[model samples]
Target: MDIPQVISKQAAETGEMGQEYLATGKQVSMRRWEQAASEFGETHCREYETVGMLISGILELDLDGQTATLGAGDSWLVPEGAPHRYRIVEAVVAIEATSPPARFNNRDEPTSGEA
Candidate 1:
């Protein structure tokens, strides 16, 4: 039987994109970006789909050539294999979840480009 797990903010594992792995399941993984730097910007494609919510601060996302600004309470999704990039307009606190467990097979890492 699978057991429920508890992870505190202090215990979260730091990963790429200045994110912390909050939890990782068989089919999905969750992460948190706490006060991410404004210089945080990267262009790349991922193998897994990503859905995220802006908990606080501003973010600008460019997905498949469409750009949008996200504020607190705003959420966005990037389909798997789609080209995307993001710029942090302000220090941000956000939460994101990825399907197929992005941490699996190092899918969480960018496929190309630099931050």
Candidate 2:
């Protein structure tokens, strides 16, 4: 995918945390999450796969019935359609790459504040 170089794109506050996203065609996406403490109360099953590297703070993810606590120096992989939930142990920042582009999947359509 010929990903464009993001020069001055702004971040959109979509979730409890803020997010900046760059979609590369309909194949992949690059995303960054801002530092914010939050917990996804309900479980979610994502239809897209994701691989991410934690940048700062801490996060605890509950996948199926297992919980993994990730610190700043950790990398993670989540397969498609996995039931999971996450809580920010502290404010967190992460860089993630997703396949089956989230925008195309219609996962969280742009909200009023979304860019």
Candidate 3:
């Protein structure tokens, strides 16, 4: 079995995915987006599947034309290769977990063009 690890908020790896902080393991990864307000109109189709929760503030998620408004205590999922986009209705602090390690081999990077 693997050893236990602890990562504090200040110790998270930062500077990817627009100032988000990340804690990554072999099979999965978690990222914290604090007060993020950029990329509101850009749509992206990621290579990894993600499950996320809004810790605070408001967000609008558009998944392949269907839209949902997310507030504190809300959670969401985006399947791999699913085209999606986010609009920040308010400054957002959120946490997301990705399978297959989204940061591995630059999987977290945005695709070449809009989805």
Candidate 4:
């Protein structure tokens, strides 16, 4: 049997924030979002690890209080439960790979004053 397949934004799980996995067991998902400078605040994932590559533009990342600016061709590993935040200095396209698959979804729209 063939595994399930989906395009980045066409998938049912995709939205303004991002996309997540529906079926469990080893899975992979990729998405791209264009962000403006200082448009988003910090985010942290407590359930899964993520590995990602910057496809284009520049990103400023704050990993547990340490800061780094990543550009195209750069990649990093984010362990579960680590607090992190990122903003795009220029329009950016990021490709992310998650392990154990991301089973959650952000269904609610962003609240006022929230990122």
What's the CA RMSD for each of the models?
1.8, 5.0, 2.0, 4.3
Better of 3 and 4 by TM-score: 3
Question: For residues 1-115, what per-residue lDDT tens digits would candidate 2 score against the true structure?
Answer: 5556553455432533356775445678777786678775467776689888899999988888789999998988888877777788899889888887765556645333233
lDDT of model number 3 = 0.83
Worst 10 residues of 3 by lDDT: 14-23
Clashes of 4: 0
Which is better, 1 or 3, measured by TM-score?
1
Model 3 alpha-carbon miss at residue 43, Å? 1.3
Off by more than 4 A, model 1: 35-40
lDDT of 1 by residue, 7-96 (tens): 898998888656898888888899998775465367788889999999999989999889999999999999998888888888889999
Tell me the tens digit of each residue's lDDT in model 4 across 4-111. Answer: 654444454555565333334445444455555665484654456778888899998878888889999999887866777787888887777666465435322443
Q: What TM-score, over all chains together, does every model reach?
A: 0.89, 0.77, 0.88, 0.69
| Per-residue C-alpha lDDT of model 3 across residues 1-115, encoded as one tens digit per residue | 8776678877767755564556678889888887666446777888889999999999999998899999999999999988888898899988999998887797866695564
Candidate 2 segments exceeding 4 Å error = 1-3, 7-17, 109-115
Candidate no. 1 TM-score: 0.89
The clash count for each model shown is 0, 0, 0, 0
Q: Pick the candidate with the highest lDDT.
A: 1
Report the Cα lDDT for candidate 2: 0.73
Q: For this target, which candidate reaches the highest TM-score against the unseen true structure?
A: 1
The lDDT per prediction is 0.85, 0.73, 0.83, 0.64
Ranking of candidates on TM-score, top first = 1, 3, 2, 4
